[model samples]
Target: MPLYKTITPNSQTTVKIWKITESFDVLMEEVDLKPKSLERVLGMKSELHQRGFLSVRCLLKAFGYDDVDLHYDENGKPYLKDGKHISITHSFNFSAVIISDSKIGIDIEKQRSKISIIANKFIDYEFSYLDENALNYINKLTIIWCIKESLYKLFATPGLSFKQHCLVIPMSDNEQETVAWIDYEAQKSRYNIHFLEFEGFTCAYAIN
Candidate 1:
């Protein structure tokens, strides 16, 4: 079993990510998943999905909880029956989860070259002032994607466009926190977004 590294942003919240080099079978064995969760895990063809579940389960266990007791809401958002707040995300070979005593969201993505091809689809004026340097641009794009993705997960709105609803504030690379706002019908609100880089990957989280 791979040891999970956890970052404590404060007393009420925790962020964790698992580097997915572990064999899928090993990770599956380490988690105490429920019958339905096991069935869903078996059904996932993408390593991303498996790693996400594995990481989420491990995070829950670290806090002395079990994934078996949790379920997803109508929008496919995972929720603990006891009302504990949680969010999960996965990309390529990495998976992450954020849990807090308050509402929370989290996302992770493997830094990739392909993001440039689809930049217009999700970015907008909110990022207009970002540094134009090549390295900085790539980093900002990844961070924006992660930030929007986190907001989308938190809102659980299926058709919300990242360019339209999720906004990332322009900031220097030295900043660890950003703001994300979602104005979809019935879900209009703002969240405190945070970003971090590790091992060539980027992660973002939003807390309400």
Candidate 2:
């Protein structure tokens, strides 16, 4: 089933990661998607995207819920009908879902050198401590990017600039967790962030 790894970050949270290796047809055979979802997948021009979409449904099934129990709001934030907070993310070959009792967000990103090219766009405070000559510089940048992306998904608020609003505390590659803040419009909030790397990809999630 390619359910690569599962983590119970806390008593109230469950994270399920799927490593997509099956053909699209195989995935389609395993999931029963709503018409909208089916159409959305079909409309995608890239098979990688289609497969990633289906894998998310497969992870949902592992959680004992199907596409019927999942939905999204006007802001494009996903939610569960059973009242649990849900966040999702997928990169080229991996996809993950995090369901928690409190608001949460998840993101999976491939560790790429190009992330440094656009680092300035989403990185500001963290840049103060990032050493470009460090062996894990790219790794650190990818983690920060994943963290901010997760924060965006959690906040689901428009006009929240990643560089200007989100701040991740300094940490090394050996650290699996850290703290981050979202300071926007005088409503300041702190979140506990955790992340891990596997097979050249980084997966991070933020919990409110």
Candidate 3:
């Protein structure tokens, strides 16, 4: 098991990251998946996606939980049988999970320049501090996207627009943590957000 890193941000929240190197068959044999999960992974056309799916189960196993203990709501949000909040994400060769006593979200993404093309789609207020010509523009954009994506998972509210509702406060250079907000439907909520970069991938998590 390539459990890359583990973070205990607070007494109630834990984050785990895994670097995927196992073949689909290897991962398939390692995790005991539910019938529905088995069918879902087997149906994935992309081998990368298949392995990512199974790697999550492998992470669950490491956390002392099984596929049987995990359930999804109609909104597709993940939950544990004991009621701990859980969020998951995978990008390319990395997958991550954040479980907490309170609501939380986690996301991982490859830091690619291509993210700049769609920056406007999910970014709005952050533009006030962004520099398109900066050397770290792509890295910054990727972080913003990951942050908003995590917020989406944490909030799990329909009709929330990343560009309009999620806002990542200004992040300074070399800063690994920041704050974010969800301003929608006359309600405003705040969260503490953290992020890290490793092997060209960015991982971000939001916790309340």
What is the TM-score of each predicted model, taking all chains together?
0.89, 0.99, 0.99
Q: Which pairs in model 3 have colliding backbones? A: none
Which residue window of length 10 is worst by lDDT in model 2?
169-178
How many collisions per candidate?
0, 0, 0
lDDT of 1 by residue, 78-188 (tens): 888878888988777777778889888888887887887888899886556765556667878888998888888877768898998777777666889967788776767
The positional error of residue 129 in candidate 3, measured at the CA in angstroms, is 0.4
What's the CA error at residue 101 for candidate 3, in Å? 0.4
For residues 1-67, write the lDDT of model 3, one tens digit per residue: 8999999999999999999999998898889999999899889899999999999999999899999
Model 1 root-mean-square deviation: 2.1
Residue pair clashes in candidate 1: none
lDDT string, candidate 2, 1-208, tens digits? 9999999989999999999999999999999999999999999999999999999999999999999899999988999999999999999989999999999999999999999899999999898999999989999999999999999999999999999999999866678999999999989999999999999999999999
- Each model's lDDT: 0.80, 0.95, 0.95
lDDT, candidate 3, at 105: 95
* Pairs in clash, predicted candidate 2: none
